[model samples]
Target: ERSGASMAQPETTRVFLNNVDSYASRHIAQVTFEACTDSVKAAALISDVEAELVSNHKRTFQVVGTVSHPSAVERPHRLDRDELLSKLMGCDVVIYNVTQHADQVEEALWAASALHSEVEHFSGPKMFILISTIMTWACSKPADPDDLELPFTDAIFWSRRAHPNFERHIDLEKRVVKMGKTVSLQLFSTYVVAAGLQYGMGEQIFHYFFKKSWLGEDGPVFGDGENIVPTIHIHDLASVVCSVIQHQPRPYYLLAVDDSNNTMEEIVKKIASVLGPGKIQKKPSEDAFLTKDLTDSLLVSLRMEAAYIKKLFSFNWVCQFGLVENIEVVVQEYRQSRGLLPVRLCVLGPPAVGKTTVSKKICEYYRLHHVTVKGTVSDTIARLVSSLLSPPNQSELSTLNRNMNPAGLEEELLLNVMRDELMTHPCKNQGYVLEDFPQTREQAKELFDGKEEDLSCVATEFVLCLEATEAFLLDRVLNLPESRVQEHNCEPENFSRRLAAYNEKQSEDDVVLNYFYEHDIIPLQFGNPNAEADCLPLMQKVIDMVGQPRNYGPSSQEVKEEERRKAGERLRREAQERAEVEQMEADEARARAARWAEWTKKLEQVRQQEEEELEATSRPMRGYLMEQVVPTLSQGLTACCRAQPQDPVDFLAEYLLKNNPFEA
Candidate 1:
């Protein structure tokens, strides 16, 4: 304690925080530099954000905001390019906050490029570009969207062109490296880095929850909120930045998010819970286009691991708070910010593509409510039975009885059943597979009726289209064993005709696929010429494709209680449904019988009409005179021709004698 070499005065280090000043100050000590932003950085100062901003060459830091200016992209007039470049040149580190104005990516990159040009050798400042997870998702796409499931890593997102805003990172990296080996460059693969109660996702979350109230918002959740986004608190982001600053991470890009692998649904639900009880309006990603583009960075989902960065710099999260644990902080911030949040798909495939089986696996993997159209009808019937039984409407209920004619009412019943299934709980609140229903485009269009007063909001998030060869599908559809066969046997000819009809139905469904695709719900085709592999690959792919949802949903006890409540009621309802289905069968039989009888009558009528027409077209025969010529004609005409030409009369007489031309 007494060794007073008069501890050398703490040399102030200049660390540029860009728009991140609010969140970075706590983690870094005294730092010097102005943080230019479109809007003032939320929690830019005196907020809860905390992170260390230290580097190898510098220790103490002083972050001072001296310059006030407009967004360089919008108000280039406000920014004195020369003065800004001078200020940048004086700084030891340049952090370009590209997150605020996506339109300013080029401006930021240009600023970095200018800074790189001004400095060289041992003088160049280290640069960091902060980017979001959507950049990564866009980058991950190949010429073919369907390939192996890949992770959103720093390396991939840094250079990819899925987004132009993200291209700034690539440009900066190239520019910095071009400054020769002395300079360093980094692109941060960030998820939702909380800025403050007012900035970044905090404001969005705040508004989203507040507006949602208890009924939930009218906005849609992207891709059924299945895509996982690696997230971090603002303080964590600053700490990550500071850690990178200190270590001077090299070889370019690094992931900046922590281990909070939350889905949009999870985050929204958590925010909802924190704010107080409320509902989350979940819809398919395709539906998001009603508000946003398919490639909108905020809407794209990216699950990343900061593996390389973590290992390279011994980086770890300094501030620990997660989805559940950070509730208090989130609530406080949300309230402070006046609460908001930008809220956050489908098995569709061709015939015999293991759609149903894959859908089951997808629901299983995601722990969603797996239901089919038929099952939904049963559920609806069960619900209907319960609804009708409590009041005991024997008369009207009998109208729904077996004798009510199922065929005539099936479409109407299904419309109601599907409406309930799609718009009510279980299927409504959670995910479900629509099978064997909406097989045609018209039916699908009916399901999402534009004219309906109360529309169905939720639909299949993903369509797992299973494909197999014609031979395989036919064999599977037709190869029922003799023992398993029934009265109206499926003969080869019938199978051919049915297959042709099936193809025609598929052709009709082309419009359905086109419609869904326009809504960004394209069919994911997985094909197997031979169905020998027992449906395992299809299931695996479904699981792989249907990214895991964050941990939430009805707990085991809740599900059990629901099951218990439905069981007793389901029995009576099942009986009613059975009766209704049987009636449908009977009605269908009668329809067929009627059609057959009408066809028979038409056939007889056609026969009679044809006979009358034939009689009308008939004429008297010139037969009596020609009858004597039969025997003469039967004798070879060639012989008559070959015989020596006789005198016309003598030849006629000889022919008449042989052929009996003269009938008495």
Candidate 2:
């Protein structure tokens, strides 16, 4: 509560981080260490607290219990109150992290009460930071624009699974603030999944739906996905927790969420694009339990305003991994989980260059499926025209025969081809190589500008631009085989016309080229189009950029078995150490008792002798004084009287004042 006074000081503060076992809490604990103390907690199997932040975490953080583990009940449920109290006694700060439920605050506070001391009058500079969710905001209302900065005295007890036990959290937060003015109670509200390489709630649910849909068991389900879901990266959330830990902000219910301005439908489409595309079936919202909590929150149109936190701590996700980017992470993870490589690329260049050749080489080198947009478009036109001519399905043919633009058909085909290739073996091994696509400005704009709704997860890591001179282009076009010319309909005159059109359309400020360059897809122009050149070096360069996709899959049995083996080792080692410590302490206690007994016996003997000596000396001295010294002194004093026996008072005074110097 008293952190305000010492906020500027660097303290070797002990922070009691609760819920450290959780996925999110571990991040907070890791980042909080740099800002707090560096002293290790002495790594032990029984110690729930980490001795150090080794990378992210070194072990599973279980609840450290005072009582021994007995499988009779849940072995690791409660903390040993006295043992925990001892640790709490040393801590200067307590970070009360709560998730899952608001009633968790009570358990945390109860644990913290062990740190309290009435006699100490702990009006603490000691702080207790309550890092809770906005779902914990207990007001009967959804959000309080007016009193966003204030506390709610009264609140509703009941809420959806999305926000349950909110009233208790509110009660706890208010009580904590009232109890400790300087303590922080930050309530963060996030609507959607926190971004990362995660496969927890929403991601796993999405994966299930994707698997079902892909297997034709079920379709991707969302009820008209226009719900606005606030999103934030896990890293950003971790950073926010660190900021609060480092600079304890003024205690308030600070609502922090990413301002990803995408509707729920857009996010799902992005997910679907990666998983595999199919028509999404409308599912009832009420059917949503865990799976639909994602969209249900959005359906509520609930969003957290990050303005408050931003004003205070400049809350921002530097990665800027927004809705689609997060979806990309989950998609990549999904693919990797299935022993599939996740990679997407596109090669764009002008007419009559080695674009197709270089792409084919790269695809062959990597065992990837090489896709040519022109060929796919041609095939698509053929198929669609054939469908239109044949009236097998009269209704389907009627829809196909509608007045559709050639350009639109080409664009649709391009997307379809890319999607189809990505879903198949093109992405099975090393991923696909897209070539001779995005020729026109519109196509480039549609693919690269993040505008096309149909195109999802079409991020290109590299754009290989094979440059050729006008003479080389003309030569390649004009010298084409008769059969090649007849097949494609690009004759010598057609080549000149195509070259002219390309030159006219292609300018230094070409939108397509600029788009790639702006997105860090700057063209790797490496070709002597005037003459044939080896493209191995260029292909290698592209490979270097793409890097190697991790071949590891998630949750292998071997890995889990290894972890179990390590846990067993740790447990045995810890048990041995505990036994050693107990034995050592017992030995020391016995040694101390023996030494105390020996010292006590020796001291008692010495004391008795001293008493005997004192009594013996006193008897001799009394006898000497009474018998010899007193009689001799009386005679000497009588002989040496100062006054000549004249006056009694004078004689007494003279005797008392007389120095025996003359007589001695």
Number of the top TM-score candidate:
2
TM-score of each model, paired residue for residue: 0.39, 0.42
Per-residue C-alpha lDDT of model 2 across residues 1-664, encoded as one tens digit per residue: 1222223222344566665655545555665654223222222323221111122122222122121224424556456667566655555556666643344667666754444332154433454556655454322354455764332221121231234535565555555544453223221111111122223122332455545433333244556767555555545665665555445544334444665545556665665555554446667766665563242233433434454345445433543445576665655555555655545667765666766667767665555667775565555556656676566545543443452465345355455454555445335334567776666656666554444354444456667767678877767767767886665546778667766776776763665677776666667776654323566577667778776543333235668998999999999999999999999999999999999999999999999999999999899889977885566557556755644575755665566446443365
Worst 10 residues of 2 by lDDT: 187-196
How far residue 545's Cα lies from its native spot in candidate 2, in Å, is: 22
lDDT of 1 by residue, 1-664 (tens): 0110111212554555444322333223221222111111111222221222232243455552222244423433334678777766665555554444455456656665676565453243334343333353344555235743445555444444544545654554455444434432322111122121121223432344333432233433556777665555554555545554443433345566666666667766765654434456777766655652233544556555655544554433433435445665655554344322111045654444345555565566555555566566555456657777555545434544543353333555456556665664334333466654565666666776635555634655566555666777667546655543332234566656655765677677365676567667666678762333475666666556655452234656779998987996898799999999999999999999999999999999999999988766662343533565555665535456667565645665676666664563
* CA RMSD per model (angstroms): 26.9, 32.0
Instruction: Candidate 2: list runs displaced more than 4 Å.
Output: 1-4, 8-11, 33-78, 101-103, 112-124, 137-165, 182-224, 290-299, 319-664
**What C-alpha lDDT values do all the predictions have?**
0.50, 0.52
Task: Give the clashing pairs for model 2.
Answer: 66-80, 225-265
